[model samples]
Target: MKRQAYRPILITDASRSQDDQLTSRQRRYVMMMGVRVACVIVGAALVGTRAPLLWLWLPLVALGMLLVPWLAVLLANDRPPKDRHRLANRFRAGQQTDAPAMSLTAEERPHKVIDGEP
Candidate 1:
């Protein structure tokens, strides 16, 4: 019987750890919230000073205040998607793909052999 070549998974192809993803999401949420806070401050200042184009600017600032939290929540809850190749086997239901599968056949797997003639 012919033996298939051994394939090794590379660390470089691995996805980011959960903690790393969470930390980044948190940073993004905080930054967006800060922008929302800035919009509030700017709107207050514009009202206090009666800046020119007040009619146009207040609505824009109000829009920012309204949208940022919703977007921030969405982004915070989002996660990186699984790689296509990783799911190919799962959905194919026995179809062979051109890409190498990340597993070994039974014969190719490592195992202990014993002899009865001891």
Candidate 2:
């Protein structure tokens, strides 16, 4: 007799289950480093070859050399924007978002006496 096995169920939430191993900061650092490598390669290649209008290309090379690291560092240090969302039922219901305006009538306002003796 042959035995059969059932398929395993995937019950995890899709968003979390498929999340990247790297955090946002790590991802940015990785991406910026990749771009930085490309910049270095291109700059070296440009300087190595006797390309025409070298003066025109000099600024590009300069920018890559000077800006790439600064930008990479900046981006790597940046944080992902915070997410803000309100539950549909919790909002616009009895949940008070704003303070109710005080009633014009004095009776509506409660008075507290310090009762301090001099």
**Number of the top TM-score candidate:** 1
The CA lDDT at 54 in model 2 is 74
TM-score for each predicted model, relative to the true structure: 0.76, 0.49
What's the count of clashing pairs in each model shown? 0, 0
Q: At residue 60, give the lDDT of candidate 2.
A: 83
Residue 115 lDDT, candidate 2, scale 0-100: 75
Q: Give the TM-score of candidate 2.
A: 0.49
Candidate 2: residue pairs that collide: none
RMSD of each: 3.7, 17.8
The local distance difference test score of model 1 is 0.88
Residues 1-118, model 2: lDDT tens digits? 2223333333531232223523665777777777778778876777889678878887786787778778877766655443233233235666665332332345445578697896
* lDDT (10s digit) by residue, model 1, range 46-106: 9999999999999999999999999999999999788987676547766756435446667
User: In model 1, what lDDT does residue 90 have?
Assistant: 48
Q: Runs in model 2 with CA error above 4 Å?
A: 1-22, 84-118
